[model samples]
Target: MNLQTKIPLKPNTYNQIDYHSKVLLLGSCFSENIGEKFEYFKFQKLQNPFGILFHPLAIESLITNAINEKEYTKDDIFFHNEQWHCYDSHSKFSNASEIELLQNLNNQIRSTHQFLKEASNVIITLGTAWAYRFIETDEFVANCHKIPQKRFSKELLSVEQITESLEAIMSLVKSINPKVAFIFTVSPVRHIKDGFVDNTQSKSHLIAAIHQVIEPRNHNYYFPSYEIMMDELRDYRFYKEDMLHPNAIAVNYIWERFVQVWISEETKTTMKSVDEIQKGLSHRPFNSQSDAHQTFVKQLEEKKHLLQSNLPHIIF
Candidate 1:
């Protein structure tokens, strides 16, 4: 008997990610999780230049800004709680000095602009449909930056709104990079703080909107990350202690499924070699001067050099 119900995933015939593919991952904390895997494999990838953007609107804004080469100025940033923050970005971009914050934001936009133009695959993971709009400026924020609760009004983005945002993102990205393949996935992290019922509603809107835009024939695809979490790994054992996020085991399982679908078969051997090197690098020697330990270190170095020689972009 089958212990778990598997989600059927078809291998992508076109736009399969290989060692040479330059990938750009945006949106959600889950994107970071998958991005971390890409990093470990030493794939050419750039993830969340503006940090983890959760909603479709925020992601749309990021794409629009990057494609247009938006420059951040003093007016774009505001001083709050003794720190300078941009409403369009995550708190990670905030800085103690306003000039530094603007410089960082503009630099990121320029970098992302270049990356998008050359990216082979663009993976977007939408986290929620819920968003907060700052009442003073009537603008949706990627993050609140811990300002007073009364300063903003929370709103749930309708499916129609999300659909439009997704379309806009597609149009903008395609305009700049016609050859880039798009992969959209809804993040599996539950927003329990939004209330359990509200969380369900938020996810439902995101799913509906994503399906409205994803066209496999056009190289725009959707991966069933949320479904896999809810079905295949349907147990609290797969969750962290908070019972909201997937733990390492669940993440690894999902990542394996992702690899089967998106990663190229030609890169499998190289991936295994990279994995071995990663593990060997993390290994601790029982005896620093032992012959066995020295031999192991030497072998690890050889593997590293071999990989780096082929994929010079890959750095340990």
Candidate 2:
């Protein structure tokens, strides 16, 4: 008898990810988790340059600004908590110096514009449909930056709104890079702060909107990441200490499933070698000056050189 219900996942027959493919991952912290895997495998990838954007509107805003090469001006940012912050970006971009923040934001946007033009696969992981609209600016904010809750009104994006945002993202990116494929997935992390019922509603809107935009002819597809978490790994054991985020075991399991579907079979052997090198590099010897340790270090360097020779873009 089957122990658990598994989402039926099949490897993509075309547009599979290889070492050569430049992957651009945007959106939620869950996307960061997957991006970490890509990094470990030394795949050519760029993730969350502006930081983890949760909603489609935030992602849409980011793509729009990046495509247009929006330069951050003094009016675009505010001083709060003794640091300069932008309403459209994660707090990680906040800087004590206004000039630094502006410079960083503009530079990242410029680079993102160039990277998006060359990216082969764009993976977007939608975290939530719920968003905060800053009443002062009368615009949706990606993060509230610890501002008083009363200063912003929480709004749940309707399916139509999310669909439009997603369509705009695809259109904007495709205008510059016509052949790029979009792999959209809903994040599995539960937003318990939104309340159990509200979280479900938010996820429902995201799912509905994503389906409306994903089509074979459009070169867009959906992966059942949320379904796999809720169904295949339904137990609380899969959750972390907070009882919300997926634990390492769950993350690894989901990653394996993703690899099964997305990673190219031709590149798996290279991934194995990369994994071996990674493990070797991380191995700590008891005696640093020992001949054995020196030999190991030299061998590790040789492996790195060989791998780098084959994939010039990959760096340890």
Candidate 3:
């Protein structure tokens, strides 16, 4: 069955599927927002194997810790700040103990390999083209400064490199789950230091790279998260206090936009109507009644409010 509503691409309808399916989100912090909304929608199989930030290194560490049966604690961590940890593109572990936490990392990848073997849909949120590599093994280390930048190298990636990385990752995903479909999105949260002009360039490169890889493939695809953030929530007011990420309202708008693409029209209409009714009830003006008449009057008011308004207007 077509999971999405078949509406015209121009002015797509805001409808998503009623029934939830298992989903795994791996990528940047934006994926966290997507995951939270899925929870709101009560998606049946939402999973975040890589946790927040969706950094490959964090996922590797998480898997390692799970395999070794050792806990991943701060003692082993070089960075404890939630901001850096959420999407650990530029963080690291303090010592060998942190590395020890990753004993199960490989095992978990093997398990992910197994699970994706049968997954129907998988979403990957690509955050950046910059990754840190260890000096010795040429492996991408989770963090650089936790050890030394000198011990590792900063490899700024091109769009081609990102496309290759996603392709490699997707290839692994497909090997484990042959029938799985893939969705790729570039994160909207800005890395301010990348320089305003440079940051914009990087995003363009990333998006272009992702499209080049996925556009020709029948099974792979892309989502316009970058466009929505840049075009829909262009104003600074839509951003959080930190001036980087989108606030709740902006995130909601993005979720709604996504629903237009992934959800069914019928379900969208029903949900919209329900939301309207609820809003109307909440907006009913203050009322008064005698103590003796309180319960009866309140009940009548609620019923009247329900019957009188088919659509509720938001006070704002």
Off by over 4 Å in 1: none
- Flag regions of model 3 displaced more than 4 Å: 1-20, 53-111, 266-316
Estimate, for each residue in 1-316, the C-alpha lDDT of model 3 and write its tens digit. Answer: 8533332333322222343335667767898888886655445344555444433344434333333344333433343432223122333312244344344333444455555544666777767666677777677754454455687776666777666666666665555566667777888988776677767777777788777777424467777887787776778988999999999988998887777677676656545544554554455445545564576557656654653364233111
> Whole-model lDDT, candidate 1?
0.94
lDDT of 3: 0.59
Candidates ranked by TM-score: 2, 1, 3
Question: Residue-wise lDDT of candidate 2 within 210-237, one digit each (tens)?
Answer: 9999896768999888999999999999
> What lDDT does candidate 3 reach at residue 171?
62
- Candidate 2: worst 10 consecutive residues by lDDT? 216-225
Clashes of each: 0, 0, 20
